[model samples]
Target: MMIKKLFALFLMLLWPSLSMAQTETITHGSLAIDRAVMRAALPGSKVTAAYMTITNNGAEADRLIGVEFSGAKKSEIHSMEMDGGVMKMRPVTGGLEIKPGESVTLEQGGLHLMFMGLTERPADGETRTLTLIFQKSGSLTITLPVKMMMGGHKTSS
Candidate 1:
């Protein structure tokens, strides 16, 4: 009798979940930050760099408007371009464009975020919270892990 009672209780608990249908979540577009960190900058330096990858899984295109960080006085989008056989980095005033079903990679020698007037250097094994504001997706909060000066994976505070 006890066994039957337990089985009945289990069935009752499972009924609700089985009856409820699951629906797929449709994200018009999404961005994933692979890894972001700040390089060692001189004291009172006016510039630093951040690298990451922006991915769009949805069917529509998206735009990354700006980024905000606590340790930096100013954050701007920048890209590296070839000028007269020389690599020159410049600020992208219009922001970075992400096409539909595509991913824009911001690696070390290409596109990156320019962090100016860093209030303090992000030490190794520390985590920094950065907010990325998008043209349509509003804002996304990401915790970037601080690595060693030599680069590679460390840990986020």
Candidate 2:
């Protein structure tokens, strides 16, 4: 038993890349989060937005219940809409429901996660880990890479 434990530890150290890849791709049950990203807020900005594509591969629906990350006092799922001629934003009280075999995209100008009271802006090339909890899929954690938001940039990653 001791030799088995040592062998396991040796394998982990021998293949560090495998561990990193596993951390980046988080899968819980039948749900998957793809292309998760958070933009660096402008200087002195206290809030920032994060976007991702959530796919429900299971036979039943799932709800995204919560979000968490470092350097954030609070995080909530929000939806942006144009009410009349003005834009409005609101938090999703219950959760965001994802139907089976459907994909919900949280991107700019739409549904996204708002990180409030950030300690510092996410710098370019910086990586942060985000934990997303679901009603049925449990917790899905991924490494969120900070990138510059572009006018024409697409969220196809």
Candidate 3:
């Protein structure tokens, strides 16, 4: 009886960490990518977005050339901006540059990874693999957890 009570207490203490998003940081050359997350696709929606922070820690600059997602038929780096009182989204041509010693954030309403024609809708609490290709660093793969964004807050579904 005492061991059962202790086991329950241990689980209660460890639940928060287990439920949190994946915190793994992937690095290639001087580039480090972290805080990677993908939003769960809405029902009947075939598209979703991913966001992350990329930092260049070396003296040379690098460019994020492309992305590979096995779950989607197509993926592109896209930017959203306001133009002429309207919001416009388009694929970023020539890739995105990361200057030396600078950090670039890919977030909502800005630059993000657009995954289109998903083979299957990713459910909340599931994980997916993403490969980021850089001009100088080659390729690096990272795992992203699917999360739901509600009212500007991330909640595990």
**In terms of lDDT, which candidate is strongest?**
3
List of clashing residue pairs for candidate 3: none
lDDT of 3 by residue, 1-157 (tens): 9999999999997764465435466567788787899988878777888999999999999999999999889999989888999767789999999999999999877888989888888878999999999999898988889987653322222
lDDT of 2 by residue, 27-133 (tens): 56788777788987767778788899888989999999899878789889999888999767889989999999999999888899988888877877898888898
After superposition, the stretches of candidate 3 with alpha carbons farther than 4 Å from their true spots are 1-23, 151-157
Clashes of each: 1, 0, 0
Model 1: residues with Cα > 4 Å off, grouped in runs:
1-29, 40-44, 149-157
- The TM-score of predicted model 3 comes to 0.80
Measured with C-alpha atoms, the lDDT of residue 9 in candidate 3 is: 97
Instruction: Work out the TM-score per prediction.
Output: 0.70, 0.79, 0.80
C-alpha displacement of 100 in model 3, angstroms? 0.3
lDDT score for candidate 3 against the true structure: 0.84
Clashing pairs in 2: none
lDDT-based ranking, best first? 3, 2, 1
